[model samples]
Target: MRKPQQLRNRELVLLIFAMALTLGAFVLVQFGAIGELDTKVLGVVGIMCVLAFALHIVLRIRASQADPFLVPVALMLTGIGTAMIYRLDLAYVAHWNVGTSNAGEHQMLYAALSIALCIGLVWSLANYRVLFKYTYIFGFLGIILLALPFIPFLNGGGNAVVWISIFGFNFQPGEIAKICLAIFFAGYLVRTRESLTSTGKRVLGFTFPRAREFGPLLVIWLISMAIIVLQRDLGTGILIFGMFVAMLYVATGKTGWVLIGVFLAGAGAVAATFVMPYVHGRFEQWLHALDDDLYNASANASFQLVNGLFGMAHGGMFGTGLGQGRPDITPVAGSDYIIPSLGEELGLVGVFAILALYLIFASRGAHVGVAGQDDFGKLLSVGLSFTIALQVFIMVGGVTRVIPLTGLTTPFLAAGGSSLLANWLIVAILLRVSDAVRRQPRAVIG
Candidate 1:
């Protein structure tokens, strides 16, 4: 194993570069939005930099052998998101006359809190494997979290019942539920891999698991459908199901599991279009976005989608430059539509850059999982990484019209406190796993 000090030094160098990238972005936003560089931008950028360095320091003391790229990649994505939101804030105040919108400032604060949480988790969690002990407990807790938004008193949000008010702050419990569920799925799959992989029905070169062993898959599918139907949230439902299926495939090394999951998911989606007006409307808007009647409709129209398309089209290949594009014209531009907002300003090149960061992050995580010495660690790491990858695909694909828009927040890049916190915590978990993987001794064969 390499020396911990050497790894920490490597991480420190990358951290400095990531901070510089963030600082440069803030500078660009300031100059482009206001036509002059203002020192006020430094307030948020400076605080974020301080918090980021503080996290690096914690990693130095606690997890020196952790993967260096994860932190830097996450920070870069979050920085780009904050810069874009800041640009939108300036536009909102100047042209839209929405003076009360301080979303950019609030996002900085949320990023700080998220980083602090990451520091605490990395500092306190001595072993990622300890979580395996509470596998069933986490599973139960995930169910409760997912159900919280259904409670009449706790449930609060428009269009989707995925938010709950806690201490006067609105949060999406589904975001937290995904983590708990990932933990649960990883641990559960570790315990059941043997049976899941046992020989069963062989159909056209694919060996499917027996009906007796299919309870878990069926239950998860039902839960996902319930989310889409009861909560009107297709993204989270699909996210949870996809994470489990990916982890299951990793555990069993079986391609049939993925096929079964896709078939179920496709069937559920088709059924949803007929059973739920919300799902049908989204499909309608997606398929006929350019049609005048649907596009111009007053209620549940494709206006937002059309505007987002136009915004990205206006940017073309290079982009309109940071803060110069009118990204705020789309509804919920800071959250679900943040990708298009970024696409419009950063252009195809910038969007590809952002996506490449996410790809690197996921690749690093998958590497950590493969290097893990224990099955539990392997499953957990892979499950978490798949969660992030699946989310980016759903959001970016929706914005580009490759799929129906499911209103999922872009991980680490969207303006949502719950999402930021959940994703940063995932980074913390991966860091711990990577550190453990590096610290383990290789076998010595006599």
Candidate 2:
């Protein structure tokens, strides 16, 4: 095992570099320069960085060997997140008079807590196989959590009931459910892969999986439909279902399941569009953007998306520059619409850079999956990676008008505590899997 001092040098160096890059960017943008130093926020972030370094030191000292890339990756994500939040806060301050409001402070707190939780989750579990032991419980709990936002008493958010307010603090349960569902799907698919692959009947050019073999997916599809119809949260329901379908295909290696999943999803989307007013409105607005009557009458419905496109266009190649662009004019600029805000401030080049980062992260995660030693680890890594990729695609595509808007948050870059914590937890799980892969003996015969 490497000593804490040895690990501290590397981790601290990475942290310093990340912080310097983030702060330097802010200074260049001139957004974070004018605010009162907000020492309390700085103090909390400082302590978190110190603690993260300390944790890396302790972990390195204890383990005989660990993945060298894990700490640096984590630091990069945390740094990007902190910088994005700070940037958004500057806009919030200028427009909404929300200067020094506890959002940034709370985000830092969530980051620190998420880091601690990640350390604990990775350290306590001796093996990846152990997750399978509680898959059922975790799966059920995930479904329940996903449904919690629909509960009348607990539900928050007007247009979308994706949040629940607890003691005046809002939390998005769907974020956490994503991880739980990934774990469940990974474990479940691994356990059932052989049976699912063998039990299906072949017809034409495809294998039609047995109905019993399709029970879990059927249930998921039904639940997704229910969510869309009842909670009116098509984004989350689609995300969960998409993740399930992707993992199932990976586990079974059957293209039929993928086709079936797509067919079912298409049906659900059509049904929801016809029956759900919100879904109908969004679709109509998306498809009929040029219709003067619709644009004139439902302008409020189309305002944010329209403004978001305008902002992105205004960004051209080099962004208008941070604080100089009218990103704050876009509704929900700090959350669902943050990508356009980024495009407007950072320009198309900056937006492309951010997208490039996500691509790098996704590619690295896929590498981890392919390199993993076992089905469980591989499936888990792939599932997590797919979730991040899909979520980013959904949100980015929505804001850019590549697709109809789905209110999904950008992974770490979006400003929300639940999202921050959930994403960090995901990265932690990925590191754990990568560590396991790294430790595997190279010459072992299967």
Candidate 3:
């Protein structure tokens, strides 16, 4: 067994390396003359680094038995996000008459807050099974939170009612709701899966679930529709519904559930396209952009998509040597559209490398689910992994135009406080599950 001191040394090394990478990137951007950098910005970043390193030490001392990969992975992601946000801020300084310092400061602040929250979450929920007890309550609360942004007095943004300003700070309830709903769905499916599979009947060619078995799904569907109607956020609504369906399939290993889900999703899409003006407009823009431009004859709908594709194409194999390319040309370079910005600056190879990291992360999560001792543990791990996988697919596909554009933030990479915090919390929970699995005893045989 490795000595505790040796483990501590390794963690310290990892934390230092992470901080160095972030600071190095900031220095390179500032010195390369790609964009101007203010000393205050660097000082802010330095402070963040010191705080993160300090937090790392605290976590190591408090949770010595926690999954080793958890803190390192979190640090690496936070570092990468900071680097990218700084790069984008530099670009903003070059183009618009806006100050780039605020973006960097906000990102750094959010990263610090996210790290603190992740550590607290990991410490508080050391035992993964505790979450199972309040799954239903969490799920209901999640639904309420999801709908909170749509409340008449609280809603913000006309494009999507995803933000609610509270005491001057804007919050995205959907981000927190996603994790809570995942927990609830995992527990619900694990408990009800046997009944769902055993009670279904073979109707014609497809197996049809009993009416009672479909109650939860119907309620979920209704909730999804409510999201679409009230928030006008088709992407989030679909994401939540799809996550539930995937978890249900994993829990029961039932093809019928998947088929029903696909059917329902298809029907929902058709209904939404015909009924909701926003949905109709997006679909129309996606389908007929070459002919009639929805956002004007300038083809602005196609413009951003085209620019993203061009960025990827320009990236080719190796990127334009970070900071050499014009990533700022793509709209929303710091948020939902950050992938293409990465592609422009880091190249296709870098993009593929990031994708591989996510794949590896997801694979590890699946391993945890398979190895877990209980149904709830299995479902929770699988659900969290599936949520990350789906989010990646949706955002990447949206940027590539493999699917219609959806304003979904890239997990870990995108510059958003809510997204960063929520994803890190999800990672913390996954680590808790993984640690439990590793500590579990093997079954005895006769």
Candidate 4:
């Protein structure tokens, strides 16, 4: 086994590279956009650098055995994201003469808070097993969080009622719910995997769980459908349900469970297209984004989608270069359409590199799951990893028109405080699990 100090040293080395990449991107953006570096932005970058190293220190002391690359990769993505937002902020102000977006500054602050939360979680959660004891509580809390947006007074009104306001601060409860639900799913599946695996009957070479064993799947399916129907957000519904299904398959080692999940998800989505106008409009925009009338529609039309596509095309293979391209022309470029924004400036290669980072993060997460000695840790780690992977697929697929766009933010690469918090917590949990897996004594045959 590797020494903890050795693992930490490796992490420190990679962290330096990640920080360099971040700082380099910021420098390019500053020079390309404003012809001069801004001291305030540099100060923000300094703070982010300090926070990154602080997280490394915390890991060395509390989670030295954790995966070395996860934190660095996530930090790199966050840095690039902040740089892009800052670039767009400059464009918005320069071209339109609008009030400063301040998105870049806010994203930096969010990154700091997220790192602090990650540090706190790593420090306090000395053992990941304690989470298993409160599985149902997490599940119930997840449900409550999902429902909070529906309350009249507390609701943070938007086209999609998915945010809740508390003390004048608006946050998306669904982001936090994803974590709670992942824990619940992991714990519940660990307890029930035996029946879910053994009691199923074989039909045409596939084992189908009995009605009793299938109850949990049905309940989760209902909840996912409720999210789609109630919240008017397709992405979160797909995200949560897909996460549960992935975890279920991992638990049972049964492909039949996945087949069943796909069918249910397909049915729900199809029914939604007919019954929900918003859903139907999205499908129309996706299917016929170039249609003159549809493109010309003023409200909730394909304007954003078409413009994003044009911007990406304008970028071509190598890209128009950071801050040289007009990513701000697309609506909400920092949040929902950040990929396109990056695509416009960074080109296809850059997008692929970004995707590669996600792939590495997800693969490391899966590695942690496989190395885990306990069932709960394995399931939780894999579930969390799958959540991030599936989210990336959904977001990228939507932007490329492979799927209709929904309101899901790009994981660490988008400007959303709640998403940053939830994702960092996941990273903390993964780190904790990795540390625990390494600390376990290896079994040997003499």
lDDT (10s digit) by residue, model 1, range 180-239 = 999999999989988999998989999888998889999999999989888889999999
Regarding TM-score, does 1 or 3 come out ahead? Answer: 1
Better of 3 and 4 by TM-score: 4
Name the regions of candidate 2 deviating beyond 4 angstroms.
1-16, 29-44, 62-74, 96-102, 199-204, 290-300, 443-446
How would you order the candidates by lDDT, starting with the best?
Answer: 4, 1, 3, 2
Tens-digit per-residue lDDT, 1-446, candidate 2:
34335545665576577666654554554433353455555567676777676667655644324444455555565655565566666767777877464455566778788778777876776676788788988899898898888777888777777899888889899899988888999998888888788768778889989888888889999988877777778898999999999999988889889999999999988988888888888787688765667756743367778888888989889988765777777877777888887788778898888787788777767777887668888888889889999999999988877778877788877778888788877876776776677667661211
TM-score of 4: 0.98
Error of 2 at 327 (Å): 1.1
Winner by lDDT between candidate 4 and candidate 2: 4
Model 1 TM: 0.97
RMSD of 3: 3.3
Candidate 4 lDDT tens digits, 82-193: 8999899999999888877788888889998998899899999999999999999999999999999999999999988899899998899999999999999999999888
Which of candidates 1 and 2 is the stronger one according to lDDT?
1
**Model 2 backbone overlap count:** 1
C-alpha RMSD for every candidate: 1.9, 3.4, 3.3, 1.8
- Candidate of highest lDDT: 4
Every candidate's lDDT: 0.90, 0.76, 0.77, 0.91
Query: How many clashes does the backbone of model 3 have?
Result: 2
Enumerate residue pairs that collide in model 1: none
